[model samples]
Target: MGLRLACRPLKPIDARRAREYAKHAMPSVHLTRHLYTFFPHLEGQHLIVEASTAGEVVAALEKLAPGIGFYICDERGRLRTHVNIFVGKQMIRDRKGLTDAVAADDEVHILQALSGG
Candidate 1:
């Protein structure tokens, strides 16, 4: 006998509501003060962005500071060499893809690496 898996598709109305909720739900993003050394305007501020994925959050941030995306990610959209992002206490796994899922109340932290002679 073959095993059958049960799966149910969401109804159109349900799907629409889910999309609406995802669009309205916002995540809190925190940027390290060190980044302000590079972009003064972004200093000491917390931003709320409606995003379900790490990449979307970055895109939302780009709206606040043009070219900020380049600092966090490379031209190809992969994470840059000196930037690190964490959701709560865990580091994101897909730095290149930024596919990590973020909850509405999740805290996203953006940090810039520091080097000294």
Candidate 2:
């Protein structure tokens, strides 16, 4: 089952608003046709994936924020540029691929990298 992502710390956004946005932001099924065919279980709302593993959680978060500072990788093994993902004490640089194992109690964090003049 997918998660009802809590939005307590989502700044200007709340859970209901965030969920609605996520529903609308879902990528077209065609875009991920090839991959979903193989991982069919990931076809739809699976976008809001939840796991006891920190690695799994980070990977899911990256997909939700595929942009600069949001390192998301498709199943094709291509890393989305400009994004960075971190899990607790570790920083992830491998976007094209990652297999880090996660535990149920581990916390997953997703955020954009900041640059200043």
Candidate 3:
């Protein structure tokens, strides 16, 4: 059986906070080769997303590489089962909302899970 995460919607980032986030130092995002293969334009490019939350980071990645957000997240905005995101060295704790905080200079690595024994 498949698992689902249900919760209240995320709060909207206010205009002022959005502006502040714009000014905040951006974090570096590194996706696995598979993603780059599908979104060729994002290959050989710097992906620095300006945001404080992982969800926002995904949004920025989507802007850089269209349709990527859909690939990483489901319709309700929860991260897909096959995707794993790491902020620095630790795997993210808030998978449902992706509310995990990401600071500037943090390395965000998006890795697709490998299966089959």
By TM-score, the best candidate is: 3
Per-model lDDT: 0.87, 0.45, 0.90
Worst 10-residue stretch by lDDT in candidate 3? 17-26
Name the candidate, 1 or 3, with the larger lDDT value.
Answer: 3
State the local distance difference test value for candidate 1: 0.87
Give the total clashing residue pairs for model 3.
0
Judging by lDDT against the true structure, name the best candidate.
3
* TM-score for each candidate, following the candidate numbering: 0.74, 0.35, 0.76
Query: For candidate 3, lDDT tens digit of each residue in 1-117?
Result: 999989999999999998887677689999899998899988888888887889999999888878999999999999999999999998998888999999887999999998889
Of candidate 1, the 10-residue stretch with the lowest lDDT total is 37-46
Off by over 4 Å in 3: 1-24
> Over the full model, what C-alpha lDDT does candidate 3 score relative to the true structure?
0.90
Residue-level lDDT of model 1, residues 16-117, one tens digit each, is: 888888667779999878767777877766689888899999999999989889989998999987888999888888988999998997999988888888
| Candidate 2 TM-score versus the reference | 0.35
How does model 2 fare in lDDT? 0.45
Point out the worst 10-residue segment of candidate 2 by lDDT. 26-35
lDDT of 2 by residue, 12-116 (tens): 888999778755542121122434444455556434345433345544554654431133444464444533445545655555555554443333334334456
